[model samples]
Target: MSVAPVLEKCRAEGRAALIGYLPVGFPTVEGSIAAMRVLVDSGVDIIEIGVPYSDPVMDGPVIQDAAVRALAVGVRLSDIFTAAEAVAGAGAGALVMTYWNPVLRYGVERFATDLAAAGGAGLITPDLIPDEAGDWIAAADRHDLDKVFLVAPSSTPERLEAVTAQCRGFVYATAVMGVTGARASVGEAAGALVSRTREHTDLPVCVGLGVSDGDQAAEVGRFADGVIVGSALVRCLTEAATPAEGLTALGVLARDLAAGVGRGRS
Candidate 1:
């Protein structure tokens, strides 16, 4: 259930992997699970099951609103595992993308055990750096879960080396320097960062932050090993008048993004 095989398969096929993100318990836990199914069925390779937090520092307004909605309705840390279980059952390699506090509060050992039991593949900690993540590292290793850490455009060479060294599934390359959101253009910084990070590790470098559509996904797929879309897909669900329409919009976008990934060279 490791995510590495999924990315490797995509690489073997000469295409970039399509990684999608959505906060768990958004719209509703059930709706979020349904959305992930649509994403996978349409074209997502790895699914980032965002564990909604009260304080989501790395997120922009779109994700922040969604997180707030989930929290307002009482989405708990345990509920994240429930959502992860459903997403995994739906046949996607599910990874929990959460801030650090929740893990610390939930107990790293307990979190890892439950996540593994739920059939999740790994974790994506945006606010936690690898150097300060010894406990999580130990727990993840104990459960054979992937450790996916972030390396931003501003990360220095030494910092990039440290982060990517701890990464297992793939390195999360934050393409944009600011908060996460959809943008009209994928930055030149993204390519530069991917090149810089590549100088350190052979792990797949997946670009995230501000990728809004298939065209942008294609643009990023050229240099990145994977393309991650968050705000755009969340917007499809959040802005839709009904849950069914939301799933339909998400599927259409996922199809387009999947095609975008294929447009890239291996």
Candidate 2:
């Protein structure tokens, strides 16, 4: 269930992979699953099921709002596995994006066990750095799940090497300096950050933070191996008046982003 294969397939196809993000239990668990299915059907290759956390330091207003709503409705940790199962069922790589605290509270080994059983590809821990990820490393390895870590523009050369060495799936290159949100521009710093990350690891380097539209996806895809989107996709559902309208908006944006990635290399 490693995401490496799907990314490799996209490489073989001469395009960057489109990775979408959605919080489980938003507008209800079933609705979230339907949104994810729409994303996959519209051309997303990998889906990051955001485990609604109380303190999401890396998320922006859009994602934070969605997570708040999800938590308010009592989204349990078990809901993550269910969402992962649905994403896998839809034929997309399913990855859980959660803070380290949740995994530790749920028992790291147990979380990995359930995720793998649910057919999940891996875990993306934003706050857990490689140096502090010993427990997660062992658990993910034991369960055969990929461990995705992040590297920002501020990462020193030594830091990049150390972090990327421990990563199993892909290295996340956080393009923006602040929290996650759709920006007017993905910025000049993102491409350079990705270039720096590539020097340290052979794993696909995916750019996230400040990416929302197809044109931006194309820009990032031109250099990075994948385009990671969250805020904008979440916004489609957050801004919609009804579930059906949200799904419609999600599909249209997903397709646009997919088309954007397709034009990356051309």
Report the number of the highest-lDDT candidate: 2
Where does candidate 1 stray beyond 4 Å? none
Q: Which regions in candidate 2 have their CA more than 4 angstroms from the true location?
A: none
After superposition on all C-alphas, the RMSD of every candidate to the true structure, in Å, is 1.1, 0.6
Residue 177 displacement (Å), model 2: 0.5
The alpha-carbon deviation from the true structure for residue 143 of candidate 1, after best TM-score superposition, in angstroms, is 0.5
Worst ten-residue run, lDDT, model 1? 83-92
- Estimate every model's Cα lDDT from 0 to 1: 0.91, 0.94
